[model samples]
Target: MKTGAGIREHGATVIVAALSTLFASTLILGTGVMTAALDPDLIESSGTFRMVLLMVSAVFIVIALYVGAIVTANTFATIIAGRTRTIALLRLVGASSRKVRSRVAGEGLLMGALGAGIGWVLAELLILAAVTWGPGLGWLPAGREYPRFDPLTVGAVGVVALTTWAAAWAGSRRVGSVSPIAATGAAVELRPDAARGRTARTVWSIILIILGAVFLTLGLLLGMLTPLALLVAFFGGLLSFTGIALGAHIIMPPILRLTGTLLGQGPTGRLAAANAVRFPERSARSTIGLVIGVTLVTMFAVALETYGSMTQIAFESDPALAAALAETLAITTAVFTGLVGFSAIIAAVGMVNTLSLSVLQRTRELGLLRALGFTGGQVRRMVIAESCQMTLAALGFGLLLGVFYGWVAAQSLLGSQAGFAPPTIPWLVVSGIVVFGFILAVSAAVAPARRAIRVSPVAALAVD
Candidate 1:
């Protein structure tokens, strides 16, 4: 029953589990492909193939592990939040806190195993289909054979399964914090303390930004690929990403207000802004996914644009070479950016879950609005407003981080090479992402808004 409830209610979260497994499977497949292509040459040269294989596998493992950990952690947090009522009931019925936590963990284990298995199967099926139709589909070189299975597939499943368990175990502790009668009593939204949130964000943001600045300064000053410079450049990039994420929340409310003021001028727009800020936690949480995805995508886009411009300027005497370099770079950048763009899938799923959960939490409030003669359209508009506010917050911060990170990457990697023109940003991709973010924001609200507007005011009030 517990497993079924989780699967039924938290379908979006489950998709994360599956995607984790898929990524892992892809990693395994990737190494296997490399092994097939590289083994014969390495063997002829008298090099040890096993070590090379291990190195390749290790890189993919780290990437898959990182992706799995974050996805599962965020997902399980959502699941735990939504299950507050059921957990409270379990506790009230003499279930020990340990027992409650164990149950949640067990449920997560079941979910993890299921998702891993399903993802592995789906990935294998995709591989098979790709192999069979790859030539026609243009996924591979013409007449190339399908990739063979690798032994590491089992390990990939294990990796994702373990990640899910760890995330679930960590997030389930929240179950113990809620009172047994949490649902019976008035709903006490568990929010991080606002002052502390702001203060911590501010301090951390400044620290990271400074750290990143130091790295850039040192890299620019020393202008070498030494250990210190590499460390500075790498850490600078990481620190900038971290700082932006932390500081985003601090700046969110103001950005949201500005976005709301600019985009929404009517009564509905005002209501949307008011509703969004009213629940600071929800609004803030909803933006996390968009921020990361948009940031990475925009960051790469900017870096490529800058590089292309530099090449063009450097080779202006030979327009053919300049155009060729720019075209090649554009294609390469698009491919790389597309890979990173997968981060948005998590954001979209989180947005939908957040919005749905929000709707569920405010059933009676929405009904009250309807009862007070506010039309259903008005309620819908309010939800749309909330989405817009979150979207705006995401874009403001995402673009900011993208610009800084992209410039840092360009300078760090290409700065030593003389005769390159200054960095140039292509705003077109950023503009598209804004529209994409907006659409994602609005689309996420559809089902939730429908659920909210359908509840009759009198019925909702009575039930509450």
Candidate 2:
């Protein structure tokens, strides 16, 4: 079947899923090939090394899948919000919400399968090219053999497809709430009061946060005994973050208001700020993906810096051991930063997509403003202001989360050997993040601002 703009808008979701699958497949297949090429004696003797490899690959796969699922779910939720009119109309024609939701989930499954296939093919080509050329380039041993296929890689594809389907189903929950009467009116978004009315969600979020805090404390206390404390801390971070995400509508508005103030009190700035807070859910959805991305990057940087500092301090008498620790930490940090970069890219795609959809949905509002003496420049500035406000809010929240999580992780893993130490702030990385965020805000706004400015007042006002 031919696809519409709605389907096309899901390009980010597909790309995220594809990237996740590709990364996971490459990790799994690459490990297998490298192990296969090793001497049998070495392989048998290196059980600990092999186990560590497996654990690292598994951790990364989980991270990829988790990030992919969140992005996909958010994308679907945004798409469904835009389709409120269509869904209401379907309801008016007697179509059940279950059927509508099922249809959306099915589309998710198909898109996931398509993305997974693309990722698999890309992985194959990438590995093939690397393996074929690396020997000649002296990157690998000349006589080593690399396998062309691994059955384990296929599991990643299936897992991604199923996860996407589940995420879509979760995202489509809003469809059930759309009444047939909504078909007669213009599409509406959830206001602050309406958002606050989700008392059950708020309560659950609080409960999760409390539980997460407990787990984090336990992990810290246990850190003196074993590195396994990190496992507890990981679950704590995940739960707390999930709770924050669930309650973002509540958490984001204040931050948006604060950031909006930074944009000055100009008419355009006021309008932009009001628009951002007007639909709390929309603004939250727009910024949460970015929050996840920044949090991850900052977390790793802080963790590595903290680890390095503590190790150096602990081994102050042994310069050689300290130097080795520094070298190892640097290499590990580089590898992790590259891996986490994929999630950042996914978040960028999501931010751009959300901004574009927001502009498209606000056509009537933009037209009204234009008709009421707003200039094209004013309209454009308004859109840009809104985008900047969201970006600022995400950056602040993400950095805070990252630092806390990073400190907890480092302390949990190293407190026994190094004792409690202050988190080593990576000022350079933080500054770079701030600079890149500004650039991202501006770049993401350009297309949406242009689209908003191009809306003809007369035509837009006439639109349903």
Estimate the TM-score of every prediction. Answer: 0.82, 0.96
Please estimate how well model 2 matches the true structure, expressed as its whole-model Cα lDDT: 0.85
Clashes of each: 0, 0
By TM-score, the best candidate is: 2
lDDT of 1 at 444: 82
Q: What is the C-alpha RMSD of each candidate to the true structure, in Å?
A: 4.1, 1.8
User: Considering only N, C-alpha and C atoms within 3 Å, which residue pairs clash in candidate 1?
Assistant: none
Lowest lDDT block of 10, candidate 1: 222-231
lDDT of 2 at 210: 85
lDDT of 1: 0.67
Off by over 4 Å in 2: 1-4, 37-41, 46-51
**Candidate 1 lDDT, 138-164, residue by residue in tens:** 655464344657667778777677777
Report the lDDT tens digits of candidate 2 across residue range 1-464: 22767565677778877887888888877776677667767867555665677788898788778777777887788888777888899999999999999999998998888888888888888889878997899776678778778887899899989998998898788999999888765556788999999999999888888889999998888887888899999999989988998898899999999888888888999999988899998898889988988999899999889989989987999999999989999999989988887777777777877777777777788899999999998998888888999999999999999999999999899888888888888998899888888899888888877876786899988766
Clashing residue pairs for model 2? none
Candidate 1 residue-wise lDDT at 223: 41
